[model samples]
Target: MSCCTPGSSRGGNSSDAAAVPGPTWRQNTTATASGETVQVPVPLAAGEFDMGDNFGEGYPADGETPVHRVALSAFLVDPTAVTNGEFAAFVDATGYVTDAERYGSSAVFHLALDPSDTAICGWAAHARWWLEVRGACWHRPEGPRSDIEGRRDHPVVHVSHRDALAYCAWAGKRLLTEAEWEYAARGGHEARRYPWGDALAPAGVHQCNIWHGRFPVHNTLEDGYLTTAPAKSFHRNDYGLWSMVGNVWEWCADWFSPHYYRRSPQQDPRGAPFGMARVMRGGSYLCHDSYCHRYRVAARSSNTPNSSSGNLGFRCAADDSSLSFGDPAAPQ
Candidate 1:
């Protein structure tokens, strides 16, 4: 289920493999947030990297191939995924209700549907099962059965673009420009297939959250999370960022179009002028090669600004001088 598509770059055996070094696995220097929850500040190292992939590991519709170089200015990012507690704070401050709650329903994955069903959603309906349930939102992550009370550290999900935008505005931060996201996710490595390296099986260990067994019917859960994990559960990127891939799809500031990257400039390009959907980076826990696999660093996907579901969430980024990226006493 790798995301590679036609014309994407494939690793040249051991050449690309030998070229890049893995992440430093730095110790956590937690920065207590302004509230009760603690958030680590991810120090963003400024640099450039070849963006996108030409390998066979991306989705065709994802438009992540034809890899190109992109330059981004330095900016700080949250070291961990946005948590329920933080999002709750945003809600309290802004009184925001996500699109899912407003619309009273959102797209639910359904793998089998009548082909002639005029109401059938596009790719979202490709899943084995999905239902349009009311009250499904960030608070009620999986319709009526889920709640966020105990999982304050887990990345918030079922968030729409509107929700993310509200949180960003309240936090005095902005969504990472597409260039900034890809570069940061690459963890300062140039031409590495993933943030870690070319090999998907790095040191016989799974690098990120992805499906391990038969997609819908079975999951090995080898990485220890069936759905989402605490934002800092796994290893961090070189910049100390967590959950850059898999777990949840993060909303970006730019509107989405398939060819946006092709026409976009290499320097801090955002995205298209306007589209029905905004660009969403990273991939969700549900991504699988048998289905959607747009989780690569260069990978891209789009969802309507108003759409919210069980799989979508976001993180906030701030200016470099913000003192919030981690403890100043903490080693880089």
Candidate 2:
């Protein structure tokens, strides 16, 4: 197990790094049945997009090895990860309580600078950058002291896969299949390391949000954010999807198997039939090239369905047939 382990969504230990603002992107809008306005998902036309890592760019695991091509049906995807305010609206409508709230705890990443802080979860054995906090939840991502006060627009975190599914269920949306996710994330590009291109920083400009400094110790905040940023903070992909490669790890609908790509169906390949963990993609703010290199377009990770953390969140997806542009169908 490496620092980029697949089980937890701890945002990485950069809480003290400070949150800086960045540019925003264009978006479409829609209203839910409950009259709550939300960002309309962009439509991705039916096409083929490359999936998985193949640049001989192997990471701590072989999950993303052997880059492959996949064909997908057209679908609609949220332009941004679900925001705190959005999730709160869902909660208000459905009275849903998140897994973190029920469990009374969620994994949180705290810097190892304070010896006392390390005593809680005793530093993750595989990734020393994470810690499990007692009161951490999506509403209080960093713990009780941390609230989504000014972060209404930021991606909602500390949500387990179940929590995300609940939101999707209420919204009449579903988690994107891994293939669909990779296709949408690729943004019509061909084998580029990131959603933008091969360059991590094109022309010395930061495109997405990821660690800008040393891993686990220092965060330079070069991208203008230490932790989660507004879902649309950075530039969007060619498909108009914002922060596709970072900010938070978006959950996928497939069960995770490192080698599942080997036998995955060529067209609209879904993951294994059943597994202990679901796929997570696009990495999080904690991602740094020095350790967790999962911020790439083809990188992959996973966590159990019940797992929750400060960096784990999700975006909603729906079949093209279901979306009606001006008004979406109510959840069944």
Candidate 3:
């Protein structure tokens, strides 16, 4: 019943093993396909920026307060989330299976499912808007009846933290730390509610993709999307990054901690030492101001490592030293 991505039960089915099998699940050393030609990583210079919500516009319980200054080293970040095409290439190269696929099901938005299919799908007790559909994974986002088809450019969903890590390994990159993500997301403009500035729709134009109408009921599609949009759909931020705060939630390398900011280090703070769930930044298309107003740059949420939903996706990042200039194989 999380306002954003909901957590899923591990082990998939009752007969499945409690532990993730095979060496490819958690290891980042697995070699897969090259991510070059998919999307080039954008280089970001190291700098100090104020992190967190100082304006008190964020969810207090989610720990968006005690604005802290953080310094980050130069790094490379993907300009856009990993697209369906990019992920398919990795699967083809490594024959990897995602956690959702192993679980035999994943959480899908109720609106995305066919009316007939809802009768068969199980609904989450806390969040009726989410349907647990069998055969629902990254490839078949909605259910067994759905496919990516012409939406290859759309961000890949139903990917778990482990799945994202696997993609990062195959791409020769890594996930952005929570500090790095916030610093990059600000795009050098501190204290802004969004990457684009204080306005959600500056000049009456939608800068990012998010819910536009009543939540779990109707969608106005004002931003031109009911689900996910193209990975690079919107305009780039000051950092030349696209979709930094919307379209879908991007997974961070740090573990979740509601109180981490209070004790976070001044330099490159990575989050808590350990936790049950991982951090996910940038609200998804399901965010609405009336309910889940977490689309702001400083907002954050988390789910278990094994969790996956249609609104969840991720981008890659890497240390600057690991990438050469103009290297297409970089993080993106």
Candidate 1, residues 29-130, lDDT tens digits: the string is: 233333645454556666777888757676677677677777777777777668888777666655676666765654433322233444433233333355
Model 1's TM-score against the true structure = 0.79
Instruction: Estimate the TM-score of every prediction.
Output: 0.79, 0.86, 0.90
What's the lDDT for residue 47 in model 1? 72
Residue 130 CA error for candidate 2 (Å)? 1.2
| Worst window of 10 by summed lDDT in candidate 3 | 14-23
Q: Please tell me which predicted candidate would have the highest lDDT against the true structure.
A: 3
lDDT of all predictions, in order shown?
0.64, 0.76, 0.83
Number of clashes in every candidate structure? 14, 0, 0
**Taking the tens digit of each residue's C-alpha lDDT, what string does model 3 give over 185-256?**
888898999999898999999999999888889999999999999988878888788899889999899889
Clashing pairs in 3: none
- The list of candidate 1 runs beyond 4 A from truth reads 1-35, 54-56, 107-125, 321-332
Considering TM-score, which of the candidate structures 2 and 3 is the better prediction for this target?
Answer: 3
lDDT, residue 92, candidate 3: 79
Off by over 4 Å in 3: 11-36, 118-120, 326-332
